[model samples]
Target: MNCRRLNIINRNSQRLLFLVNQLLDFKKVEQNGFTVQFSRQNVTNLVTAVAERFAPSIEQMGGKLVVEQCERDIEADVDAEALTKLVSNLLNNARKYMKDRIVIACHADEGQGWFTISVSDNGVGISRDNQEKIFKPFFQVMDDNRESKGGTGLGLSIVQSVVEAHKGEIKVESSLGNGATFIVTLPLRQEGVTASAGNDIMSPAEDKGCSRAIDGGVNDVSRPVMLIVDDNEEMLQFITSNFNSDYEVVTAVNGKEALDKLSRHEVALIVSDWMMPVMNGVELCRAVRSNCNYSHIPFILLTAKTDNYSKIEGLNCGADAYVEKPFSVNYLEARIHNLVEMRKLLREKFSQTPLEPINTIAPNPVDDQFLTQLTNIIEENFSNPELSVDFLANRMGISRSGLYAKIKTLANVTPNELIQLTRLKKAAKLLAENKYRINEICYMVGFNSSSYFSKCFQRQFGIKPGEFTPHSL
Candidate 1:
């Protein structure tokens, strides 16, 4: 038999095995209730293995499957059997809707105690409206031809159950005409604590991982908000004095108070002491990781708890970075700068080159499709003067905030900035051709006012549009 036929056989065998296990799991749930048997498994390998099982089907659909390996192995205390099913269900779900491409990856956010595996696709992207319903018992992406026939309608539901059983969480990233990304995050081993799926120490996973090919994430202009939580007044003052010059620092006595501060402000990073009067740093880390709004913030735990178990506890609770007391101010400062810079780079979008010979910089299919479709939308409506975030978001079928976050994560720019960037790049191209008058070229690229176009043109190209004829351009 050919390799392709063998792949198809392996794919069918995997799916058949998944369904049999599903029946057994249902019986177990009905009789004794669902549960997980924790074992130390290398998550990166698990994700890669499961993705390979679906490779034949993905290929048969005229699609490609890409497995992204992380910088290191991400091991977690999980039920190998259940985790396999969880991954398998996710694969089957993707195969049902996605036809062009599929990419799977796993990574360990050690600071936040999260090990994540994402399966993304580049076909029949789910709409925001259906996202809410897709996880329900019998929901499927709306299609008159394929709607009720996708599967038992229990794949994602089972996937969700498996996630909760492992004390982890799952979420979907997608939009109409943009592909979907199903992100699953699980807990790793933390000493001095028993593994329980009940604890649920995790964030929503990602709105997060963007790549800019050779470049990186855009630095925020508004002094990025930083929150510091330490009960000691002297330490707070000293730390605040040092960092205030670079960051807009806010101080809190404990984790509870820190959360209140977070609610009122959009904080980019956090620094906290492990032992405090009311709520300690570990507790604060857990709280932050559980909240989707603040989970993505980089956390640095600064404290005296320097033991191995203490470090494990701190990281397992979602602390992104750690600093021990009696530390040098210079040491802490350097660590903070490095962590924040890495975070910035991770959020930058793929490449910004034109769409003719497309180069995808995103880590997954969902982002790749979104960027491709977004580029198409911009080009198709290139002459429409009203092309803005709202317009783009409406066309994409996602909310304004969802659009903003995804674009920011994938492109490292605000919606307005992306629109302006697209328009300006087009305008620059027209200028290079020297085909029309400045005002005419401006209007041709969707600019309404000539003066405003000139200002923007100068801002982007470092010269007045008039200075650029064919030779000058």
Candidate 2:
């Protein structure tokens, strides 16, 4: 048999196995005997592996499956076997209803203390009324012809049970024509935690400790831009007024509008409401984190949702912090200041050690990958005197201005300065090796004039090249 045909058979067998397991899980759920065996496991690795299993089959069906993996693995106390089944069922259902693409995103919010996994697909969407019913046992949304697609309809039902058993919650967002997104949020650690269906598992008091009141002085001129989004005009103005003295406050009524503002302005931070028309804060957070341009911006989600699951959902989508509604203005302002200052400190660290590993600071995966690629390119071409910022930008597949901005934000240095630093570091290494004279090493590392190289080296290292020793690094 051909490979494609064999792959189909393999996929069918896996589906059949899952169906059998689903029926067994349904029985367990009905009998209330489905006890989760919780142990600490790396959730990111497990979820990524499960998502990969459906890729070949989805591709065979002329569909695409995109799995967004995190840079850092999230270790959580979970029933590994049950979580595997939960993800498998989600992928299977997406495969059934998806038109051409399915996206799976996984993130862990240490700040909010939740691990989140979301499965989305572009296909026939679910209506608001049916959204609640779709999780019921043996429930399926029939087509216009009043025919079921296929399955016992126990997949999502079992998924919900697994989530509840793990003291987590599953939520679905969809409409008639738009696609659907299923978000499953679980605690980072399941210990001494008791929860029942529809119960608030955690108290807001547990989150109050995260609110730091450190003050970073604000400037009157050239203030950092802050985006405040809310559907309610009153709430929008309220937040804007509070931050007006500190930031160049811009207002948007929804996530779409917020994104429009992001494109037009260099936003320093974002504060948004949870519920709104067009798009909500969680969706906006996800969109911002998915794009490299805005991923590093500190996001603060303001919501009335006090439940543990809701907080996890918001933070897992990449909100740097969460503030419950009717929140203290002082607390909110403190958190905003804390997040901005923390990023500034991180940038300072990176600037001091530009050649350090990206994983050292544990930035988002997108930025980590970008910096890794960038450093590799620079290291490979550092000896080329013709290597310019524009050339590096082209190689990085970004505009010159974008590269300049990213490097400045990330490393607290311009692109040209970064390149020069990279060359100087290389020259430092060569000098430490005691393998060549200063002149030879200077020419070898792309410096044409020894006198100029000496000056730059002294400026960067606070000592002349000849004064550099192995311990100086």
Candidate 3:
């Protein structure tokens, strides 16, 4: 075959593949939902790259690619990857439908905290009736001599989705005989701490340092630690800014990174993105649950995947909460505080509650057996005031660390907590039966101090032992 003819065939194949890729990309956004990870980016450089990429192709089709003399380097909080795709899709539509030339332009209005990008083509324009439906997925325009063309109608739909993900707007200005211009306007930054304005310019790689320590500041060991996981750097910074006052915020780019951080840090809670490059949130949740040390940490998955199936899967994977993207900052702060408080309550409850009797208490059979054996040993040593982790470890034929790992994995509570919980349950039962006075019950259940017993009981069940009579029980 002639080389020119073969090249033409190759071009067609590339276009088909492009369509397939676009379809897959859009489907993922639709099914899993999308969260725009924002950062400071040069809109001009991004658009220029896209234009240069297709310039040769446009030239081959008897057209020229012109980047207009608009604000060339507008820097703002934008998801560069999504913006790249959006601009590429618009360029592709222009290449396919109208024009001897394609033009790209951008403007930034910092006063209004907004920015805009417009792509125009002088090709065969769209009719007013058709313009209304152009951005709908797979809606191709019909025109004179429109036959013998290969195109996926997904281009504009993808453009629209990207715009919406950034909390932006998109519209078309066109007439049948006139040309078409697709313009996109986006906020320079989202309002208040759910997202922070990034730097004036950025590279493809993000700084991973912000999550652990910022500006090389010494680590504050006194503050409670929180793990913020999201692929977007701006979001991580934003979340950190909001939580830094109350908690020591550490950042991670994805689930895998978060897991690595957990291996090293005593994180109190985790807020993660559902979809990310390395490992997504659900996988991280499952991994965290399976781990002995990290299982007890509260997990909140912040994602755009709000579909029922996705939400259920996230919850099933061990996420304590599911927060959708474009989420309210107030709601997120409240939710985080709530999860932390709930976690404290849960651990206290685990320390006090009976873990045996699978049908009644334990959820899994393995846990039931483990708890049954552990509780039996506790009962055997119930009267010993010297009962401690070292004593329990020796009795169980495991090291202290091994015991901690086992109990944490099983009940998301420490072995010491389990022992305390066992004793509390015994004391509560004795009190409920009115078989012993509060002092006697405390000593009998291995508690040295009746006052301490009262405090623990109040914390576990919201009632003082003296006030929690048989009738109350």
Candidate 4:
């Protein structure tokens, strides 16, 4: 197991795995199990990461590989895993036939709402007749002078399947002796998701079950606010119409507008589209989770990306659930209801164990940090009888009402109750230690009145302080 031999084995293993994956993918297509799972992806990043994977091998083979730099990030709703395969297959084919160089470029047309990715190589170009037949399964160009390049010959066919599944088109430009370029054009967003551009327009068909126009704000303050964000006006309308009876539906065209709405209203949950201009869904989810004020609200990502990778990424970003496109209305409603009910159950659980690590309750680092800071403040001032909610809010650099709202939302308890709970939990630990007298333990934990402390302690732990034993803990 020398270093060089190990490296060679590793490289070969990777190549073999790649080939096997390709074969499996093509098999899936043949069996009609190949599905495109679309999500909001940065086109430039996807292209760069995928093309760079092949760059080293191509350069090692003495071929110059150039991935053109885009001026700005181009984002689109696309099946990332499938697109990765398509780029890899094209690059692999080019590497096998390239004389010296290969080039990859991406361009977007904002007006037409489409983007194109082109891969070109200075290889033995396909003939006019062969170009038409190249994407067929197991079809390969046979030439007399060139060495036989080994492959399953299903690369172009898989690429075509990926493109067609995404409702896009792919074309090839090539002639004998000249280089060949494969150009793939896909929509910036999927069809049926037209850009609203901050407008709230809906078709007659879309307006069938809706009563009022979506005004991009809270509809009824009496109901729990649920923010619905999407670039498609029709989608916003559809969701709002369905949830309006039970929720104060707030609509936004994109993530930026959604954040604005969140700032103004107390949202119970969020249902956001993955792809949009200004900001995307994953970015929004991260932002919400990082903000202590909104972190407790359950988030559901509405996307066409049903792939396991996309679902994991979405959930990792703090989304409570991921709903795929063309999803059933009943299923989406159920997911939303379950997530909201789950949050309420968590609140009840946290309320029962107020001294528990807040991170365990919220499961978000930012929320944990905020809760820990609050807990630390309370613990430090436990001996001071003057400690109050207003003092705590001032120390925490938040307004009194804001602190109350946040604590209520996260802990399901008032700020004053939280302070008392912290003191009682410490008292219980001291009692369990059996080193302090009952009155001493009460005073040590910040209770001036021993009788009052015992009453509160008994109320919390369900036993009189004098009868408390380690076993009761």
**Segments in model 3 whose C-alpha atoms lie over 4 Å from true places:** 1-221, 344-376, 384-386, 393-421, 434-444, 447-468
Q: What tens-digit string does per-residue lDDT give for candidate 3 at 433-462? A: 887788998888887887877877766555
Point to the candidate with the largest lDDT: 4
For each candidate in turn, the TM-score is 0.38, 0.49, 0.43, 0.51
| Reference-based lDDT, each prediction | 0.70, 0.77, 0.72, 0.78
Model 1 global lDDT (CA atoms, 0 to 1): 0.70
- What is the C-alpha lDDT profile of model 1 across 101-162, one tens digit per residue? 78888888879888888989876787777888887765667654654534567778778888
Q: State the weakest 10-residue window (summed lDDT) of model 2.
A: 211-220
TM-score between candidate 2 and the true structure = 0.49
**All candidates in order of lDDT, best leading:** 4, 2, 3, 1
- Give per-candidate clash totals: 4, 0, 5, 0
**Per-residue lDDT of candidate 2, residues 27-74 (tens digit):** 988988568877767687778767665776688789999988687888
After superposition on all C-alphas, the RMSD of every candidate to the true structure, in Å, is: 25.9, 20.5, 14.0, 17.5
- Residue 306 miss distance in model 3 (angstroms): 2.7
Candidate 3 vs. true structure, TM-score: 0.43
